[model samples]
Target: MLRLLKVLILLPITAILVVFAVSNRQSAVVSLWPLPYEIATPVFFLVLAPLILGVLLGGAAAWLAGGKSRRLARERARQIRTLEKAATTLPAVLS
Candidate 1:
């Protein structure tokens, strides 16, 4: 069931990508200044590279932004464990 759903979703996307790649096969020159480096690549690749990079950077940024919340949750769990241990030991010490 899940496999069928995945296939259904991916089939159209794959077809679209194939069409895009086929239509945009022209070569494009990419140059980086101050380094005297130039690369010639397909238009499809030129378009896709930046998109992939943006997605990766955006995901990394989001993960880093959530670090504080994750750390706080871990600290909260540790505090709860310490409190539970003290509560269990308190009655014995009192008696």
Candidate 2:
């Protein structure tokens, strides 16, 4: 089911990207203003670089934002383990 969903979503996007890349085959000059750096590349590359970068950066930001939540969950899990251990020992001691 998950594989089907992935295929459904990715197929159209892959098709669209293929079409875009083919349509934009012309060399585009990408220049960094201020310093002398330039490269001639395809237009799709220019679009995808920032896109991939944004995805990576956004993922990092989300992970960083969830740090506290992750820590709390870990502490809760440890607490649950300790309580369970205590409960087990209490029953043995009562017997």
Candidate 3:
């Protein structure tokens, strides 16, 4: 099911990229940023920018989520350990 969704998504993306590549074969100077870095070939940016941004954003989001998940797991484990220690000592204290 997941694979089917991935294939469906990629089909349109592949088509769009093919069209973008065909349309942007010419070398056009793109000065959208504060610091203008020239792309000798427009096709490179057309294909690469989104891929790079996707990877960067995915990595950042994953890193943030991973930290939170790790923290939560550690806290849960700590609570469990404390509870177990208390349970082991309760009979000794009562006696």
Best by TM-score: 2
Work out the TM-score per prediction: 0.62, 0.82, 0.49
RMSD, one per candidate, in order: 4.2, 2.0, 5.2
Per-residue alpha-carbon lDDT of candidate 1 for residues 9-92, written as tens digits (9 for 90 to 100): 989988998899899999989899788999999999987789779989999999999999999999999999999999999999
Off by over 4 Å in 3: 30-39, 43-51, 70-95
Could you give the candidate ranking by TM-score, starting with the highest? 2, 1, 3
lDDT of 2 by residue, 26-93 (tens): 88998889889998999988887798899899999999999999999999999999999999899789
Better of 1 and 2 by lDDT: 1
| Candidate 2: residue pairs that collide | none
Off by over 4 Å in 1: 1-15, 33-37, 87-95
Give the Å error, residue 8, model 1: 7.5
lDDT on C-alpha atoms for all candidate structures: 0.95, 0.93, 0.85
Q: What is the lDDT of residue 66 in candidate 3?
A: 100
lDDT comparing candidate 2 with the true structure: 0.93
lDDT of 3 by residue, 43-92 (tens): 65766788979989999999997998899999999999999999999999
* Alpha carbon lDDT at 53, candidate 1: 100
* lDDT leaderboard ranking: 1, 2, 3
